[model samples]
Target: MQNTPENDHEQDAAPSKTRRKKDMHALQEIGEQLVELDPKKLNEFDLPEILLDAIHLARPMTKHGARRRQMQYIGRLMREVDMRPIQEKLDSWQQVSVHQTARLHQLERWRERLLTDEHALTEFAEKYPVADLQHLRLLIRNAHKEKAAEKPPKSFRLLFQALQATITEV
Candidate 1:
């Protein structure tokens, strides 16, 4: 016999414990993969062919061990690379225009609209009504609050109160 609507509702409301565990594991794997795609990894894959050919010459094997060994080599290189110094240098050498700051504020507001009001965010992030955008919502919400706090609020409360007082007196 097919499950009744009530039974189906319960089934969906309480997914098997195993299914939740599997989903959590899948999300963890995706997070790890994203963290591993560092700027150095991107550059290594995108560098000019001549430079790549030279690096390839130093490692003349197409063996499966190459990837494992190269990762270890990269880990070592990462320790020696001071990214903060480079970032500081870049920041010192570059300037942000007022337009860029305004654009950032606009992005912040969009993130807020997506977050505190999540049905819309889910549609945007997943392109489906059933999708969850909870994590993104939290991230954007916090950032939006921070950005809004940075700006002085426009003054309308006194004028609003004066108008209200006049109307009430009338």
Candidate 2:
């Protein structure tokens, strides 16, 4: 057969040995991450029982060589399963964690502002109309006294809880 553009295109389309190795290594890394996940979290993936058994089997192995081989076996098993949904779920879980962290930071900033600034309550009420302004004002006042007396920050914590409830409701 004569060399042709079509033949060259087919060759290019085929994954090279290096590419296959990289793909296998990536799958292996994902398998490792799966092994680290909690059993409950792992069940969410709905993996094949054989793969799940392999993962569960690997979970308790302390020997480095044995665990590595089990991981390789898991990777080999993973090759037969579609990874897109699993990867997507993992990514979404990460996104949820990031969102929760950001939300906590925002609530903390609000708590600080309310503690230090006189006008913060009014601003908070305006932003979150569902807030119990009277209750919050009382908590803030008590929180100030607690800070001055160096008491356990019960009111401060209550104030944060109030803010969380008020903010999350909206």
Candidate 3:
């Protein structure tokens, strides 16, 4: 059989249709993710008013069917807006969250070291030059005493707070 122009056009259209479907699915996934975000975080994105309203409306939807339908509506609205800025903001928020978690872990490690090792305080003060060496020393000593006496961990909490503040300022 001869390859006609009509046959070639049909073949090209088939791939385009599939690609459009994939794009729709991707937009729907982004919409679903937005719905799952807390309202405060959701407000960080520069979204269309209609899409933002849809998202807010979906939040109170307890019934699964209704929520799903609302999400589909959100996805439809998303297609009319530029998605690049939204995606970039989401990516940056995730990165900031990850950085905060890592910082918290580092502070915990420092607290543990201060409690377990005598030299840890010197190392911490050296690393965090702005830290009040004398205050940290007092807290660490009190925390150790509290641990040995099996008393409330007031000093331990204070030490952690001081470390957090010092690290955050840096």
Could you give the candidate ranking by lDDT, starting with the highest? Answer: 2, 3, 1
Model 1 lDDT tens row, 110-141: 44455457575644544433333454545455
lDDT of each: 0.45, 0.94, 0.89
Best lDDT among the predictions, by candidate number: 2
Clashing pairs in 3: none
Please report the candidate that would top TM-score against the real structure: 2
Q: List the residue pairs that clash in candidate 2.
A: none
TM-score for candidate 1: 0.20
How does each model score on TM-score?
Answer: 0.20, 0.84, 0.79
Off by over 4 Å in 1: 1-8, 40-170
